[model samples]
Target: MVRSNAYDLPTISVQGEIDHPRLRSLGFVDPSGHAQLVALGTSGIAYDVRIGDRAVGWAADHVEPGVSIRHSDVEANLALAYNSCVGNRAIVVSGRAQGAEGVVTGKHGGALPTDRLLVDFSPDVLDKLVIGDSILIRSRGQGLVLPDHPGVSVRNLDPNLLDRLPISEVGGVLSVGVAARIPARVMGSGIGMGSVALGDYDINLFDAQTVEEFGLDRLRLGDLVHLEDTDNRFGRSYRKGMSTIAVVAHSDSVLAGHGPGVVTLFSGSDEDLVAVDDPAANLADIWRV
Candidate 1:
């Protein structure tokens, strides 16, 4: 018999907010001719699109007709650890294609899916990807786990703003880092929003204007947000002093039930963090001892 919670289990909590006054003006309307106040489903979340070697901000899928999901204020993934791997190498661990390898385009976030390390292969290679298949990432930069450093923290972020912010780079690399820790209680609707109940948290990356205007820019993509240890049932706190780590990716995706970018990693119990004002600080400077 197939066991449930085997792969991609849900372990987070989500709440809805009804303060979107501009949603209707943007053409979102209900059947009553008023601004449609639909519950932002798990489709509104998204991840930063990495085209070549750039973080292209956040992009969500269709929410309503004519209301295309644009790059809004959102947070990027934080808590990144560099592994020992070269570029363009593939490492397949899970799924039916276990032992199969793909090309490593580059690393984006700290973890795997949440910190989505981009891997490119032929269409035939992608065809082998299964739902429960775990990717064995290999390279000179592999298995670099996020340290429970006291200087790091994260908060709930908005995705819309992440799509608009200008790109920042360091040593020709994208300059992204975590700002603070956020409880899973603040995550909203999107594909992984359902996965939140599975002990995962979505990352946001945007600007402040988007936060006040559409609440999108409040976060950026690379923010290292924290997930409170809690029971998926009743959405109650489980480990009073424990938590997990995930990087914000996006709100939705082109594939069904596969929106947003998430990379999950096992964290220790006493991983404390603090907030920083500028998230775009150079990685070398911030992580410097």
Candidate 2:
């Protein structure tokens, strides 16, 4: 197991809140099948269209009901936001849920207020957790990589999580098993960003017919996805000879150009990329969270 010296990075506890401000989706309908006047502002539940019941969450990417985190130091907050990968452990350090253990199911970030982390716990744990409770994420996997493939750069990933995936070289190609393969062209909102660690990018699932055609509607929270013709080693950009793998971090949005947000996991050039179908390619299934 390739581990990091900072694997035991100081655990930081941040407070949670229901931070939803009034949002206006001018002249558009979200995936919820309605034009809403006011979006729900609360934590612990997702309000939007989702793929499967077994999915860890169904929260929308930008504006949805989920736990929100904020820190005074920008660097520490960014580190907390960037290094923490989905499926990583999150512990409740204070308030009603003190000593409770949970798994990071997803993360949503953009600007102020809407930025938040989504964690899934048992019903009992949820009942115990309250606003302002301390959620501590044991941050790790900041600069992850595939040692064998010097060409690939991994980010926002947990090495233990990566090792769990059954990766193999078949016929001289790196075949990665995923719940589904997404075309790079369909990726929208945050295309020209620098690096995948800072935040997550959304998949554009606006066209209902197109979504059904590509089978993108089957995407579930925590499912790993293979992005076609994309690269994110240095920064997220589109190139013919590039490829990237990311996780489904949040649910579909009503906002015009947003869908399930994906946090990067592995990225490399096309020569080293290959993807195949695996029905059980989800973090929830792999980690049994």
Candidate 3:
């Protein structure tokens, strides 16, 4: 069995409020040079979008599924984004939806407007939510380590979720099931970020052929994706024989170099970590959120 230092980790409380969605004053221009003005970024509560929904073809740019939040203070917001792990429990502490429970579904590194955390909630709870509502998350799992597989680094994934992943180790190689494999070359925005725990990079879908070739057009919000020839240990970059595992946290974008946002979950050398295709390999299915 795969083991980690999960039992020894500390789970802290981090608080944030529903963030206000904002669009650029003049809007943005697409790759086709078309200026578009639409709903974009950080909606307090998304009633229709859920974990298993499609990530592409949204009328929005960098759309975050479920509820989005941020701390009013810059430093605190940074902590909220960096510390909260996917699968962490989030509870509403204020507003009409007080006491409502949700799951931390994804995190977006300030790709466009601001950095935010995505939380999935029931439709009834969403109906009662409002902007500025406070949420408290029990944050943990940032420094998770696979003791038997030191080469594989775990980040931004909850220990509980990690325990549930279909992971197996044999002959010095760790195999994980993923919904899809993303080519490293198709990666865009947030590529040069110095840290993976703070935010997620985008999957560039500007090239229709590449998107189709990789079957990315049907990507879902909580899908587990494998990044081929990708490295995120120190920073985001391409290293031969290395791969990274990430979860789709946000929606598709019309902006150049910006598509669905994905937060890193695991990364290691190809020799030590391997991915097996399993169409059912997604957070929505695994976590049952």
Best by lDDT: 3
Give the C-alpha lDDT of model 1. 0.30
What TM-score does prediction 2 earn?
0.81
lDDT digits (tens) for residues 1-289 of candidate 3: 6788998899999999898877557576789999887655556678888989899998767778889998878888888888999999999999888999999999986642367889999889999999899999999998888888899988998999887887878887889999999999989988888888887899999998998999999999999899999999988998889999999999888878889989998899998899999888888898676
Arranged by TM-score, best first = 3, 2, 1
How big is the positional error of residue 254 in model 1, measured in Å on the Cα after superposition? Answer: 13
Pairs with steric clashes in candidate 3: none
Candidate achieving higher lDDT, 1 or 3: 3
Please list the residue runs of candidate 3 whose C-alpha ends up more than 4 Å from where it truly belongs after superposition. 111-113
Segments in model 2 whose C-alpha atoms lie over 4 Å from true places: 1-36, 41-66, 72-75, 112-114, 170-173
lDDT of residue 90 for candidate 1: 48
TM-score of each model, in listed order: 0.32, 0.81, 0.96
Clashing residue pair totals per candidate (backbone < 3 A): 97, 1, 0
How would you encode candidate 2's per-residue C-alpha lDDT over 1-289 as one tens digit per residue?
3333435445444444323343455345556667644333324444332223322223333432235454545655565666676656777788777888876655666553345666666667766656566778766666665545666676776556667775776544566788888887788876787757766788888766767777887777678888888888887788888888887766666566677788887888777766678888887678674
lDDT for model 2 comes to 0.65
Whole-model Cα lDDT of every candidate shown, in order: 0.30, 0.65, 0.88
Per-model RMSD to reference: 15.2, 4.1, 1.5
